[model samples]
Target: MEGDLERNNHILGDRWESMMSGHMTRIANEKGLDAQNFRCADCTSPIGIFYGAPRLCWYTGEYYCQNCHLMEENMIPARIIHNWDFRKHKVSKRTMVYLTQQWRDPCIQMDEVNPSGYRYIDELKKLLPLRLQLATLEPYLQTCRMLTPELLSTRLKGLHHMLGNPHIYSPHDLCLVRDGLLYNAINKLVQFGTKHVRQCALCTAKGFVCEICGKDEIIFAFDDMTSQCQQCKGVFHKRCFADRCPRCERRHNRNTPL
Candidate 1:
């Protein structure tokens, strides 16, 4: 079974490479430049480093931001890419950083279901990273106004409608909404934001499972400080597994989420 899973992963990795190569070629052709000189598919900026490496697309093999990459993977609502033209809503540098921290980055790797019963996922606490949540309420908050809980819920429901009512929308419809949203959101942020940093792709916890406890849920996702073993690429809840890898029996330093 483990072998099969590894085989599948290998196959997926190869397919991703092929598709990405094709994507880059297409972009290069569109822009009349070699893929090597091309910038991020969304931002068109030179790649920068974070966590000590140039931020390259896992699929596209191009420099890209974590937020845009997550949007590409549907980790966040693709619609947010288009929900508002952030370029038009520009603020000063100080305010921009504050807003990015408070309103923007939070939405990156957000869970599908939010605390206020405004959920994109049917199950509670089942995460859909990069999907927006109460952070969607940020624009309203910045206006120095408050949305009653009921109003917030109503607005969420309405946004869900604009995204084709994911609750009742067919799987195909959901894909369409996500694709559209991603394009719009990525285009705007790459153009407007003052700072761009590479975020680790694994931070999303998309396929992570705990080796020590054998439960996936409640394991850490972005910046939650979960412990990881470098050699085995295995993750564990810090409290459950400490100092040694249960699978490899290797004793080494554990890394915390960034």
Candidate 2:
């Protein structure tokens, strides 16, 4: 997980630099290009005074010939990252193909890419809590040997990643979020997982009893009313375990040399 995060951070850095360069190119081109030797950005085909000016690709802010830029339209990652814009713009065929292939890759980290953008996207805000709950339930669900992939296939459908990891999101996922479909899908997944853990005998055994309250009810670490000890990892009712964990102290006394 640490390695994955480090790789993602590196990718984000590269993407940020590319987006900034593209933005600057667009700004510079706003006033029109000066008379010079023109060529396609991809194929390097001459599109000069004799062959007319090259077509502009809205994605990379570069010029390309008709063969290279077939007027294909696609969502720009730069626009999505910087402004959360989903509108498609005219792009080169190569750019379109690349974007399409990368659409389903879980690379985008919205918090790092655009922190303030979350405030503008209400659906994303709603999805955040559901993802957090799902993240918490992942370990319990995975421990249930009886729980098969076939059982979850219908509920998860296209979003198997929700069960595995919650932080990373694909561009396709964001599109679904924008359409107000992903939230419902994830909400149902959380409900399904919660139900499974509560009912399954294998999952139920994993639940922690509130040591402080000495209650018969089995509670999970994910429960809002439960608190976990940082040292001993003992779970207890929030009200019962006010600040400190007694179990940690007891364990410490036992381990200490007399």
Q: How accurate is candidate 1 locally (lDDT)?
A: 0.37
The C-alpha lDDT values of all candidates are 0.37, 0.74
Writing each residue's lDDT as its tens digit, candidate 2 over 51-93 gives 7657777766677788998888977665766566888888888
Cα deviation of 210 in candidate 1 (Å)? 0.9
Question: What TM-score would candidate 2 get against the native?
Answer: 0.76
As a TM-score, model 1 comes out at 0.19
Shift of residue 162 alpha carbon in model 1, Å: 32
| Residue-level lDDT tens digits of model 1 in 33-124 | 24545444455555444322234432233444444443322111222321211122212232223333433222222223223323533321
> With candidate 1 superimposed using the best TM-score fit, by how many Å does residue 157's alpha carbon deviate from the native?
30
Model 1: weakest 10-residue lDDT segment is 191-200
Highest-scoring model, lDDT: 2
In order, what is each prediction's RMSD in angstroms?
21.9, 7.6
